[model samples]
Target: MNTSILFQNVKLGPFELKNRIVLPPLTRSRSTQPGNIPNDLMATYYGQRSGAGFMVTEGTQIEPRGQGYAWTPGIYSPEQIAGWKKVTETVHKEGGVIFAQLWHVGRVSHTTLQPGGGAPVAPSAIQAKAVKVFIETGPGQGTLADPSVPRELTTAEVKELVQLYAQAARNALEAGFDGVEIHCANGYLVNQFISAHSNKRTDEYGGSLANRLRFLREIVEAVSAVVGNDRLGVRFAPLFESTTEERVYLGLVEEDPHQTYISAIKILEEVGIAYLSLAEADWENAPDLPEMFRKAVREAFSGRILYAGKYTVEKGVRMVELGYADLIAFGRPFIANPDLPQRIANNWPLNQVDPSSMYGGTEKGYIDYPRYAG
Candidate 1:
């Protein structure tokens, strides 16, 4: 098998990865209920895929109102923090570095997942479309339902949310995670504030580009203060097109996506975080990000840059070799291939994910994927 740059050791902030292969944060609704807490089963699932040089936990809600889906784990509660400790300890035992992805779904949530059945909050009261949020119906059961209209968060509430982000970072550290990643991507809360289409607020959090970026800036400051900028990473989903795709809701495309994301990247640069993760659009036939934007990103951010979006091994190696990205993340592939880095290094056969058993399932699709026999 031909060797690739992806197989080489790389320095990601303070940690030395065995290779550049990364497992991006993937949401698997397998957490135990009653509190949406991480459990032994979830630990087993993450531990099985610890072969990656760096692993990011599934998107963990920072608070109850931040939850958009059913059965995902949280980082705010005492039990949730303890539950996550098992995952981090297990990954460490396997000689892998893992980071907790701090997430807040914002308007992507439903009242069923909110506190006291209140409306999910966003920068504005706009309702999200073209996507479904998983809401628990009964014991161990969930359904994809349309998102409800969200209430615009007041300025005071926004500040409190920033503090909550800092607290989440503290909880992540308490859980023994090596680092944390602020989920500022994929049309979530931070993205909601950034996109002009969703944010109609006239306050400092909305309107002009500078105003739109305030929420993200505040979050970076808060999280970095607790986790230290060197141990923090921020992820952004920058989609340049709105072409119909399986998951259309992720694209918070703007008139000038290049400018929009460059500005966002510049903030990460100013904050001096460990790495910047840019998630490209995965929709079929989606327009590839222009070479110009990629060049701009390279110049704007001095720290390591990671890109994930249906990346192939050949593509990842080429990107790294060309200096476009320092690391690559394998999402769906990691789900079905526990020993993904080993398989990639040896060019072994990969398993196809069973879409039917992807979410809200037992160990069937989550932990039953066999490693390569070769």
Candidate 2:
């Protein structure tokens, strides 16, 4: 594999990517409490990873009812806006471009995380299995618990959610983000609506594949109107597992994933969006995404395609060389090595991440990971 290919600059919509390396959105629940607001610490963490060609922020809740995890930042409040302003400014000062990932966890949440302690909302009154939601038990303390059953949304509320997504796009721009990515993957809100197992709604928003994708189309269209198609992107985690493997929590393997996701990408292509991020199933022994499916995605989608899973420098360069993906995202590796791109380019030693301090911690594991020793 030609390692240099990963460092080459490429055009990504209106803005040019400094390299083919991307920093995908990672959820580190460290925002200030009482009000889920971004802080200086969060800004420091992102600023450290500015070497990426493009970076997407952690899942930022679009509204109060959208939050599913404790201490994850929201985009609806004035304080949240100001707090994120610091982050955008810091990243920009480091010569990096950043995008806000708009997110809603849907039924994969406990009632404690919902507004008024209400049951989380979904396309149907179903509970997500195998995954646990983080709930704040006390000051600076949280616990993992089973998700609660959700309440089905009325047609009117679904319409309002479309408006909410648009407003969140406006908020992201107000907070100084270069663009926004709709988080329609990982069995979250949009994914729940799209999945046949999670959604049993008999309304226009469910039933057929086209009907199931209606909510996603509406949010993408609504968000595009605000951010413009050139500045918008969508992320879809299409899990393709063999029959031998057990179904995972975040990525529910679809019976016809190729059709499901290619159709989804076609919608984005018609809208003329900036890029599409396809997150591969990242679990141990997860079957590799089929080459035929990859080739089909490249042909079906017109925009740039970015991929992330458990990618190494060699594997990433090979993917780009094989003409499958345009950009590669380093998730956990970036977590441990802030100057990850530089280290890879120079073949430098990397730091190992502290598993214990990975989620909801102080700056210990966040920004304290040093660069390659000289």
Candidate 1 residues 61-120, lDDT tens each?
A: 999999999898999999999999999888999898999999999999999899999999
For model 2, residues 1-374, the per-residue Cα lDDT tens digits are 57899999988878888899999999999899889999999999999999999999999999888888888999999999999999999999999999999999888888898888999988999888767888998887889899898999998999999999999999999999999999999889999988898888999999999999999999999999999998999999887774443334454667898999888888888888999998877777677889998999999888888999888889899999888989999999999999999998998888987888777979989989998879
lDDT of 2: 0.90
Evaluate all candidate structures by whole-model CA lDDT and list the values in order.
0.90, 0.90
Clash pairs detected, candidate 1: none
TM-score of 1: 0.98
lDDT at position 268, candidate 1: 88
Clashes of each: 0, 0
Alpha carbon lDDT at 349, candidate 2: 88
lDDT of 2 at 341: 93
TM-scores, one per candidate: 0.98, 0.98
lDDT of 1: 0.90
